[model samples]
Target: MPNERLRGAVSARELTTQRCAELLGVDPKTVERWITRDRVPHRAHRVAAADLLGVDETYLWPSVVDDLRTVSAGRAEMVEFYPSRSAVPLELWRSLIQQARESVDILVFAGLFLPELHDITQLGERARQGCRIRVLLADPNGAAVRRRGDEEGFGVGLAHRVLLSLRYYEPILAIPGVEVRLHDTTLYASIFRVDETMLVNTHVYGSTAAHNPVLHLRRVPGGRVVDHYLTSFDRVWTHAKRTSDINAVIAAFDGR
Candidate 1:
């Protein structure tokens, strides 16, 4: 059993032993043991566990337990939906993107990958209009493809084809405001934030990526905890790669 003091600090939601065990491919008993014994898992496993819990490492393995208690007590209104149409609401995406007068940062497997969605002229127009437009995408051709250079196999891959078409936005490489990267991590997640507001897309509970539900949440006044969550995203953005590396594969679909 965990220390009585420690038990007092962890919330019911954060103590999701059953869900964490499912994600870790372990029995719920094992998860309880880890928490009871205060045995920290490997770094990668802890990160995975945190993702499964829909919170950050700071929430799970924080240096100060009191901080976790403080944050876990706070809550925000949330909405969940799946945009079954060809694309998520363009107006909604644009609204979030446009709100970034200081910067627009997107991190996803494929950023605006649908041909129907590539509107850099408009995006660039936004950039030109002074909103700092930026993105961190998985390599457009990161996944192994049966076809030499076809773009329609994977849901995210198909969406990537549209992003590859707009190359003039060069130098949108992996530098602070702009980045493109590929990761094999199962943390296939998407986030959009405008100041304190955040929209999180979870690729869970669906057979495929496109059908997964997205959760939208806004930061209430005087509640700034979401900022730390956004900060974690910036950390991931900092490590992403450039589009140039996957140009060859993406180029093959020209005129398709």
Candidate 2:
């Protein structure tokens, strides 16, 4: 079940030593020998196992997982680094968002990454279950968007993306336990958190978001990283305009 909890560790098919050996045209004893010796299969067999099991090699060998895990309290618990935003599994995202008990917070431009990917009804159910959802999106017409556009030479392209992102959640503006806001300030990083776990996507100049590194951090006692990120989310949420008032916020920028 622990392996099941990890996205890439489970297979759609049965994966026993006999099954793996059959896939590799080897004896079951060969597979058992590798397991007993605490070793992985050879390169070719490893690939075959991964193929038959429908998992990544890293998923089978946690010690060699490409993702980084930072140690704390000498326990090496509660921090991860996915190679890229897309590399983080959709299941993990859904699991975190659906399991939140206290709060689910998101701060980003257009907010398309999460909103567009998930079912709004499921999110509403989470709210009905007492999880507070706060979403902050960049105001397409705001100064921050303009600066980013000018800096990136994208002009209206970035602004249009923000507008599109906002529309994804417009229908859920009235959903209980869910609140949306539009922020005008410079966005340093995009943050998505569900209760104690937080995923950070830092902005890199001239680079697309999908190409950026992602840091996944779980709350640890006296941990400054998670604390700072949550604090920042709170601060931004305070200054952001409510979804219903976002038009007024934009009008002020347009000198309406």
Candidate 3:
């Protein structure tokens, strides 16, 4: 029992639970149950309530089930998939990154597009504001990049991309609350995690990362995909060498 009465998203919308129930033609207790259980009403009811309450359905009834800190929000599945990583809107990325207060993680091989796409300065500010940012990059000289290149039909070309991308992220070393490391694991996916939500790009058998679709996953009760990837990231992170130690190699690649 997580003090259901006091957790009032309704207050933000200027409505009471009783009024919400009336708008949905449900009993006040049912609405209370929905709140207590951290669940949303039926689709039609939620739509009506959203219209009546003047909030987006997502705002009016967010995925309480996937809110990592909440207890027992009910059993539900809320996974979204994108056609490609580039297809994911920039606004979503900015929102997720800006809103993250606890932890942020990135796992990728040749993540050259990330620095080009998002503002690294904003990420540094987030680190300054107490967000723990952990980044795992592919060891540019290691076998993992070689394997990834062979698999992607590029044959070591991606190693250059990895080196170039590392240069873009190197300055973040001076930022507090951040760690950058290099791993040699055969990467199966490129992950961008903000707190409990993640955008995972699964590597295709013989395609470049840009051609692969991205899966947007939120942590939800009774589901383990998000947790599974989180565990994978943790394992890789533990085995990775800190960039401070790997800088010699990065320097060797410079002026090439």
Assess every candidate by TM-score.
0.51, 0.65, 0.67
Query: Positional deviation of 62 in candidate 2, in angstroms?
Result: 37
Over 138-186, each residue of candidate 1 has an lDDT whose tens digit, in order, gives 4444442212123333555544543554353444332334434443223
Better of 2 and 3 by lDDT: 3
**How far off is residue 137 in model 2, in Å?**
0.2
Candidate 1 steric clashes? 4
Clashing pairs in 2: 71-76
How would you encode candidate 3's per-residue C-alpha lDDT over 1-256 as one tens digit per residue?
Answer: 4324324556666778887778679999887876787666665666576556544455555564454533333123336778887788888887987898989999999788888877776778889999999998888778888888898887768888887777777777789888888899988899999998999998888888887899887887435467668878999999998886446767665534
Per-residue C-alpha lDDT of model 2 across residues 127-246, encoded as one tens digit per residue: 888889888888777888778777777876777777666666666667788898888878778899988888988877776566678888887642346756777788899899876654
lDDT of 3 at 12: 63
Tell me the TM-score of model 2: 0.65
What lDDT does each candidate get? Answer: 0.51, 0.70, 0.76
Error of 2 at 90 (Å): 2.1
Highest-TM-score candidate: 3
